[model samples]
Target: HRATFTFDLTGMASKTTNSRGMLPDMRSNLYAAVLAGLAYPGINGHPLTEAYGVRQRFIAIVTDLELPNDPLTVLSTCDECDRVCLRACPTRALAGEMKQLTIENTSIPFPLFDTFACDWAKRYSLNAQEGPQYWGVDESYPVPENRTAEEVVKAVTRTDWGVQKLHLNVAEECLRVCPARGTR
Candidate 1:
């Protein structure tokens, strides 16, 4: 029989984390899709950063027995939706626009995302206007709209739960707006 081991990389130390805050050299994508059984379309038609926001690392043992391959993830859900993420973003980070990426002579449709704006929102403010309420963060933190990205990062990093140490910050409103997350 074949065996597989999967490790959730969330909250992993920065030393082991790559620039993306994920464990270096781990093909978590393939294993996350296979094991978690939940993946949605992400930026540039790629799989979502993690299956349900839980990053994973995997190790598999090649054995005499072969296991069936998992079914490929489909992007039907996001494609058919009303684009809540785009509208819900307080910083307007996700424009309701489709971008094309060509791979192996095939074109794929993905959302137009603004990472800098997203980072600004997550690091700086609670975004009480259009975004979800982040009740967990202390009220003393600087408001995001008035601050720069660098300032926001500095403020959050100094907290007891920074992205560096605990990976905590303002709630991810875009990810939370997705309906699939709730059903899953």
Candidate 2:
């Protein structure tokens, strides 16, 4: 089981994401060979489906609150900062600061943790633009243009966030930024 997970990470790190439009090289080539189960299909997007083996799906993701960034509070950036993946959402879905606590009714809505919503929305937006050229995960949704942001917001209430005293979704955004494709 661990080996299977490791393989997924290895493949994801090499080929899945390259928005910088770098020339493809076999030496640095890493992409799904149409074998890693298309995570997106035609519309919407995908959230986290598993964690270390647990079936805890997330719109955002919560693996990080369990293990937060050491300097997450500073809002600092590095020399080679490519926050495009972090800033990909037009709705500001993935923007969040790292912390261990927050407020919520049933499930806390952590931007970092909740990649499913933003990821789904990102893919959905891309689908609307490209018409299914890159359906990474196979899901469906009514056309987003037909609805208002508030309506879409209504669709993702706390229940969809999850059920718990608090939620943990740190990696969802960074993770969804072609995260399976490890950058480093």
Candidate 3:
């Protein structure tokens, strides 16, 4: 959906009903105030217009909203908007104080949060087994079946090839569970 623009599927010039969306659903909000927070905070005294590099980039948008020119107001979600994402994430990447794994850490894997990743994981996770079982197994990742625990630790912490291997083996489920509310 358009973040600031709307289109009429019925071919009306504009919507006769609500111009912006009515309200966000309280049950399944995925933004949880972090990634979504970044969208409108107006980094460096400008606005998301600067940070997002586009006038249109937004997060957790259930439908197009009538955000005012004031960027701070864009973050006002209703109370009790259940952050299913906090519960859904296998990793505790989000925080009570700090939220979200930076793109530097996760998007190479999971801060890779995108509408497509979330939607696909939701569909794929229904089968459970179909989703990768190694949900939070980042620690055990570098070690195979026969490797000892000490060997595993040594392999994972080193800056050598083992670190690269661990990075490669990281699961991205943390990013995939967040549902996207708007079109990319």
lDDT of 1 by residue, 1-184 (tens): 6555434334221112222443422223433443333454453222443334323234344456756765444456565567676677777767767766553344545465665555455534434332223334443443455556576666656655333333333434565565544223
Error of 1 at 87 (Å): 1.1
Give the range of the ten consecutive residues with the poorest summed lDDT in model 1.
10-19
TM-score of predicted structure 3? 0.26
**C-alpha lDDT of residue 158 in model 3:** 43
lDDT, residue 165, model 2: 41
lDDT, each prediction: 0.45, 0.28, 0.28
Using all chains and alpha carbons, the TM-scores for the candidates as numbered come to 0.48, 0.25, 0.26
lDDT of 2 by residue, 1-184 (tens): 1122222322322212224332221111111311122121101122221121111221212132343222112111211346454565434444544332231222222223243344334333322222222323222344344455565554444112223343221222333343333122
lDDT top scorer: 1
In candidate 1, the residue pairs with backbone N, CA or C atoms under 3 Å apart (3 or more residues apart, or in different chains) clash, namely: none
* Root-mean-square deviation of Cα positions for candidate 1 versus the true structure, in angstroms: 8.1
For 65-101, candidate 3 gives per-residue lDDT tens digits of 5554422224312112354445554433233232234
lDDT score of residue 93 within candidate 3: 27
Q: CA lDDT of 80 in candidate 2?
A: 31
